[model samples]
Target: MKNVVIAQSGGPTSVINNSLRGAIETFLSSGKIGKIYGARMGILGVLNEELVDITAQDPKQIKLLERTPSAGVIGSCRYKIKSQEDLERIVEVFKAHNVGYFLYCGGEDSMDTANKVSLLARERGLEVICVGIPKTIDNDLGGKLQEDGTFAICDHDPGYGSVARNTAINVLEANEENKASYTSDPVLVIGVMGRKMGFITASARLADPRREMPLLIILPEALSQDDYKSNLEYITEKVNEVLKAHKRCIIVIGEGVNVGDLGILKDSFGHAQFSAAEKSAEQVLANYLNGLDRKDEKGRARSRLVVSGIARYEKPGTRQRREIAYVSEVDLREAYEVGAYAAKLALNGETGYMATIRRIPGEKYQVEYSKIPLNVVANSAREFPKKWISENKVDVTDDFVKWAMPLIGGPLPEFANFKEIMAPKLCRDYIPAGLREQGA
Candidate 1:
């Protein structure tokens, strides 16, 4: 019996643990595998020879993983393998530990790492079967932008649906808060996690598909990078348009929007950590609207446009990806199945491949599991369809709504409201004593 090792890298999602559980359960039940180990803190754990014996854990706890959220169980890291010596050391450790099967769960960078390990093991005459499980909330994984405004290769990543649902629910809840507090805070700016991609930010539209809400979605792809002034002006213009019509506006902006310099930090993989930035996109936009730069003749900051109160900003940050309460039922199931499929591939001696989810082209929502060569998706980044960005540039098109609606699982919770019922007038309309001179 050959041993199996599983490691997770990069960020975690609400259903990421379900994928871990899926692989573990599959490997254990195969009967062909020996002790299973989880690399403590991803590839760094392998380099340091710190493998946790997962086989010794209680079956009940293992089963509970299906509901558990994030990568807290096995731990994860953003460490990138950039050296030849580190690659050799990983093979040496695997050989000494008798690790014959290696499964890596992460996004594009992790797939590249898995592909490298597979190739190195083969070159060293070691027969370790390596596989990758797709996991990323950004949904910027393998896929080609098709003319139909949909993606190919992999329809969506495991973590995206949950985060997307979280975004939709967040918008719904924020709408209620905005409706209640619009008198004091007429504009609400919400920052969602998405760097250079708008999948999560665009998901906000799912909350009000009828366009009843005064919401503006600011995608990073839709803004100008070289000109932050123009971007700010453009966003302010959009926000005022909504405020003019509805008296209250909600702006959902991507973290990577080119509003201004955020002084964002970078990870080992070279991706920007917008959450750790000195300032957030929403905060910047809010400050701009609140008159951070524009001033009156006396040098006093100008008030917000056509509104009584200032704009307030909120950043959901990592909660958008790891909140257990918002996990989509569809996403949870798919995460598990994709993981189990990867284990099955490894058991069948498949190498240099990653498990993938593909959508079936039909009216009914359906998907099939398959494998794609790791090299094909190793460093691939899917671009959100430009055609899907509405002509106004502040919203996503209906075509995108049709393509993404099913992935979020089921209908969101509906809130009730009382219809306007006015009583008989007590007296003729008259201006208030305080506002008579100013308004009447």
Candidate 2:
């Protein structure tokens, strides 16, 4: 029997489980494969030889996976597998389990690891093949054409749409809060997702498709250092102008935006998650507006307002990604398909390839699955389309809406309102040394 091993790593996504389900379903339905095993917590588990034979349990566990949220089930890690020692450890585990196919699910870094394993396996004459499934909310994988500016990978990634909806609605709801509280807090500023790539940052435009909202988006790459302060000043002036007519104005700031003194979060890949643990860009802007210069055109005292980031990772950002209600059905299907593709590649004697989502040009929002060299994917970075951004660079253009609106689908996701939850493992009691040695 050709035993198969599957694992996931990096940050978790709303549909990460769907990909896992796809791979399990593929392996179970195929005769070439036998018992399916999962590394309890990704490559680290593989190195530790703590393999869980999931196939021994009822296959219905796959169903639970679809609903299961976060990386807690099989677990995931940020530990980079870059050394020869790590590679040696993986070979021993795969040999121990008679694993013929190794299916990995994660972003570019994970893919690179998978590629290395494939090379080592071939050198050692092991028959196993390795394949990667792309999963990141940042959507930093894949590339777009510099010509038409459309992404080569599917328009948006699976995880991004849900967060996009969250940001959109969060901005919409914040509008209510901003408008209502603007009298006391005249300026409403929000931080968004996007460190280097503006994918998450640009999605804020979807909140107000008409560009009617007084939204100001800032991204790391939006401008050079010299123009950043001028941009903030422009936004403050606009906030004041809007305040003249109404009590408050809604301001949207990207987490990656250079709000002078605000801080940002960098993931394992060094890409920013835009989480504000230190201080938010919104707070920075609020402080700036509050402490205006000695003199002004009208000599009106600046007013303070509210500041928040709708989807920052610093403060338990899982709720925004895991909640099923906010997930896009379109994304759900694509995620599953991508996972299935990864499994198929593992079976087809193909290795060192990522199951890439590619957008088909034309009317219907269609995608074709193809293989890209993992090395290419590792080095490349995808950003929000420049043309997609309007002149202000805060909002996405109508074309951006047309491309993204379809990816999210029309129907809202059906998630239980009360919400099922998970907690950390608790140690009930300590066992004696003798008991512990005996595997108690």
Candidate 3:
């Protein structure tokens, strides 16, 4: 029986722990596996020689992981492996612990690290099998786009479904608030997670598939930020147009949208930490909309409003990824299956591969779990298809909505609405005391 070691990396999603649970359940039942250990804080834990005995944990607690959100059970980290010594140290640790099977769960950088560790282990004469389990809310970990209007390698990532649902539901709830407060704050700018990709931001459309709401979505890829001033002006112009027509507008903007300098901080992988930034994309856009960024030659405010209200903003931050209440049924199930598949791969002596989800092309939404080379996914980042972006760039196409709808499991909860009934006027028109005293 060969001992197995599992580690989770990068930002966690609502269903990330289910992947851990899936792998553990698969490994425990396998007679070919020995001791099961979880590396604390991802690969850093392996380097620091801190491994938790997953096999010794309570069985009830193990089964409860299906509902557990995030990576708090074991832990996770953003520590990058930048040197050969680090890889060598990882192999040394595995050899010392008699760990013959290594299962890693993360996004692109983690996959790259797993690929490197697998090669080095073989070179060092260690009979170790390393497999990658895909986990990212960004939905950027996939191959090239196919002619059929779907991406290859991986269709969508495990964490993405839940985040997409979160974005959609948040937009739905925000719409009610915007409707109530539009008289004072005509524009509401919402910032959602998605480092550079537009997938999470695009999910806002799911709340209004009929396109009846006064909603605008801004993807980082949609706007050319070479000139930040023009970008802000363009967004301001678009918001005013919506304000002019609807008198109220809700804008869902990706955190990576380059409205202006956000003073962003980066993680160990050099990815921007938008939540930790001095400014946010929504804050910058709100300032532009409220006329704070634009001043007349006389130093007076040159407001961008087509209506009589200021623009407000809100950021969901990390909440978009780890909210247990917003977890998608399909996302949780697929996350578990992907982890189980990776474990099965190791049990079958498969190496240098990562488990992926590929959508079956049809009217009825379906997906199949398959394998792709770790090196392939490691070297590529899937871009939101250009065809999916609407021509105005303020919205996504129905094609995108159709493709992502099933992953969110099912339709969202419907809210109540009051009928617009007006009371009959029986008295003469009268002005309020303040207005009558000031003018009439």
Q: Pick the candidate with the highest TM-score.
A: 1
Candidate 3 regions off by >4 Å? Answer: 295-302, 427-440
Candidate 1 lDDT, 1-440, residue by residue in tens = 89999999999999999999899999988999999999999998999999999999999989998888888888999999999999999999999999999999999999999999999999999999999999999999978766544478789999999999999999999999999999779999999998999999899999999999999998999989899999998888888889889999999999999988999999998999998999999999998999968788898778656776789999987878888998899999999999999999999999999999988776778899999999999999999888889888899988778888898998998987777798989999987796556443
Per-residue error at 315 for model 3, in Å?
0.8
- The best candidate by lDDT is 1
User: Candidate 2, residues 220-309: lDDT per residue as tens digits?
Assistant: 566555566876676666666656565556666655566665556666566555453477666666566765433357885343323211
lDDT of 1 at 226: 91
Give the alpha-carbon lDDT of every model.
0.92, 0.70, 0.91
Better of 1 and 2 by lDDT: 1
* Residue 85 lDDT in candidate 2: 85
- Taking every candidate in turn, the Cα RMSD to the unseen true structure, in Å, is 1.6, 14.8, 2.1
lDDT of 1: 0.92
Cα-lDDT of candidate 3: 0.91
On the 0 to 100 scale, the lDDT of residue 362 in model 2 is: 77
Give TM-scores for every candidate, taking all chains together and pairing residue i with residue i.
0.97, 0.83, 0.96
Between prediction 1 and prediction 2, the one with superior TM-score is 1
The 10-residue segment of model 3 with minimum total lDDT is 431-440
